[model samples]
Target: MTSRNTRHHTVLAAAIATATAAALMGTALTASAAPRPTAGSGRPAAAPVALSAAARTGLLRTARAGLARTAEDIGLGAKEKLVVKDVVKDADGTVHTRYERTYEGLPVLGGDLVVHTSESGRTEGVTRASKATLKLATLTPRIAATTAQKQALGLAKDKGSAKATTDRAPRKVVWAAGGKPVLAYETVIGGFQDDGTPSRLHVVTDAATGKKLFQYQSIETGVGNTLYSGKVDLATAHSGSSYTLTDDTRGGHKTYDLDHKQDGTGTLFSQDNDTWGDGKTTNAATAGADAAYGAQATWDFYKDTFGRSGIKNDGKAAYSRVHYGNAYVNAFWDDSCFCMTYGDGTNDSDPLTSLDVAGHEMSHGVTSNTAGLEYSGESGGLNEATSDIMGTGVEFAANNSADPGDYLIGEKIDINGDGKPLRYMDKPSKDGGSADYWTSSVGGEDVHYSSGVANHFFYLLAEGSGAKTIGGVDYDSPTKDGSTVTGIGRAKALQIWYKALTSYFTSTTDYADARKGTLSAATDLYGADSAEYKAVEAAWTGVDVH
Candidate 1:
């Protein structure tokens, strides 16, 4: 999902003006021979009408229609809209576009769209809209470079990363979670942080299967490396336990232990990054809380929707590592560990660790183990959209008051540095340069923003009719045919997309592949002639993908 696309965001105004002139006139006109039309001109002899609120909205709708290739391609849900403004011509008299919108408390930087023209007034050659969010500053190097000071503070990448070597020594007796006899490996990780903190650990293994059953990392709490120090007591009745040791002056020494008891369900391991304002308790607490919510959402989306257990379909226990790589701005899943990681922001610790962000990262693991979608071109876009679709479903499944279900991504994380949602499903271009539907050129942009086409398709498939409000948000979507649209709801749309991701999609998939996949998935869920199928087709058609 991190793969880069080549679609640059810079837009030339002269090109757009030429395109507008071509679209307005019946024939091509040389720049030297044609008289320039003024902005806001409704006639062919005049420049294209100055972009108004209505016109901007219309342009987004048109883009959706042009790019969409299936029912799943026009699925922009309500509660989101693309707002474009601040259009200016460069010294070369070429037009470059920018947009402004607020999310949470920050402003989002949108991409640029360039316009090119043919001789006829008929519009042609509108090309190259670039992504704007790249403007966000890079993550802080200090946080990424510094290691956790103590064994308690550090959550190793995995037990394997911290495994001790058997120097042909005799086997050592290790105690299991129940304090029973077992074989174990013991070791110490020195130079834990720049300040010379150390990590002590013991890992127990299943002699028969060679599988790791338990890992214990010590917790140390102190003041400037001279205070309270001790091993954290993490009592585990079942599989294992984890603890984060902190040096708190107010409380002296503290350890937060996560243990597995004879309980109904165990903890989930998944990491999602976020840059918040705090480096200690508050931020850590939020990561813990988000992890819990994310696990629940993932389980619900799969179980309630598809009747599947955790990622492995065998109820495999997963782990999550938070505060990875200092001020890390993005979250991702590592296949080797089958876990997720999160990071804090550079400017204000605005952690990218939102609910959707968590789901998105974890879904990447799912995709990797399943479709193994190559993160480039059409397959790449599908991969990104798959994360988004499921991620959105996870948000809606939670149905929380703080973060209501919507089609928007990063609405809570403030990833834009300005408080604005990262992308709009109804119109991906609101973030500037994002194609609302499938485009041959889609494979040419950044995966983060290029994902807009598929995101829009999902929105359209779920909510066919435009200009309606759902789940407490307003969306004024327009259909390609100017017909009313209807949605099959986010829940159903996710079911279809997941089924497609795991069972239908391949490395070369594009918009057409997505269309067939969803239709088949819908037929499997609802009858072939069911309203769901009808809605899917209608939604696709609304975006000009029938």
Candidate 2:
């Protein structure tokens, strides 16, 4: 169900430090005064905070109350009802709480804002994603719901069943795509597409005119069974004589079975004893083990490498659901449920739950919470690339013996059943669908294929151009201009990428912006004139991103 248009992500900080007394004293700040620069524009830098364990707990406990007062202090209209979505407490005790707005009881799609608070319980600044006022002409739509549903169905790519089904009535929402709020009908169309892909299309149409405004498929497809990564240690909880598949060490991440259903969590994996599974798909526990291991490894990679507490950076682990749907051939990260779902492959023999696939899926959650790169155009490609890059990083970080790290993605999963990997980083175009270099039309390509540009840039930045060998795998990366770029090593490359993603890149950021962001990140981590910074610049140039 993954589409090029889906969008969501974690937080990126933009600090505006004005005296707290001024804000408390009722100083008027216009909406434009809120931090709204594209992520990585390098304005209003965020200040890191360090808070003790006890202080962090206390701050979270009072965050909701503070949000209400802060909303008023920040000039929010009385009608704007802000619902807190996430709260992040930095090490320095600065808390950034994300909020979604609703007007007259209808959800405001683009009116998300974040309120920053200091350790002393004072408002520091606010970062708003939408500057549009949420005043609509009317809540009731002139277009009938039936007509809207018909329009939505007409626009759907998959009209498998002459009539698409919806779970509920079309909801009224404020469409804010062009930075102005418009009364619209948000419709969900569920069915199978012409290409056999599952569809959970979310369509937004103008309520007054019935004109289509926006649409994106909600089903994210990306998974596995008998333990793909081989024998691995698992953290389990024992209650009486049965053990559950919950990892206490990694934020209590649990694995569940969807039992061939497309909706709801099926069952928590449990057994009578510690002995989990044989190396075969017949045993469901085997698939659960692989999923659990993947989550654990990915969690450890983020924590140990980037110092991120977890996927949300709040030390809260996202659970994993395996065996989702019947003979399904994909895996996805759903931010709404805050969990990862993996489907049993075409025949249930190849569950798409390999390490890299798991890493890739979970990284989507990371991207959703960070830059939230819009899943379309160049930004979408970068979003997919972020997942691939981080997934590869997790693989390398794990250094697992059975499934050793390689630049190839999903190599062991046999996703195509042809013994060929899903993608190759060194020569991305080798797959026949990916672009080896960037072009003006690159944004028009599928996100998975267009991701090659950034993937290539990362490869060149980390391992340089031309032939090389690492971890028993061979790679020959080519540059656009046939120039030989020197390596900055993967460690430094990962640091720059992570920093750029979390601190700089925004939803609308493109390839050019990515180049600038990585450079800024490199400058922050290394000297502006350091070799690592130079390498980053050269790598982007090598990918024709300049």
lDDT of 1 by residue, 29-101 (tens): 1121122322232211211223334544554454345332211222211322233332222111333222222
- Candidate 2 lDDT for residue 487: 89
Backbone clash tally for model 2?
24
Quote the lDDT for 367 in model 2: 76
Model 1: what TM-score?
A: 0.51
Error of 2 at 266 (Å): 2.2
Q: What is the Cα-based lDDT of residue 509 in candidate 2? A: 61
TM-score, per-candidate, Cα-based: 0.51, 0.79
> Cα deviation of 31 in candidate 2 (Å)?
16
Candidate 2 residue-wise lDDT, 1-546, digit = tens: 122222121111011110111011111112211221222422112322333345546655676666567668877777777766555554344456656677777787655555656668677665554555666767778889888788777777444433466744588887654456788888887765443334566777889999877666554555123467888778888999999998888888999988887677879998788867787888888888888888999999887776676887777899999887776666777776788887777688878788888888888888777656666667667878888898899899888888888899878776666788877898898876788899988888777878899999999999999998888888999999999999888877887888667655555566876887787666655656678779998999899988
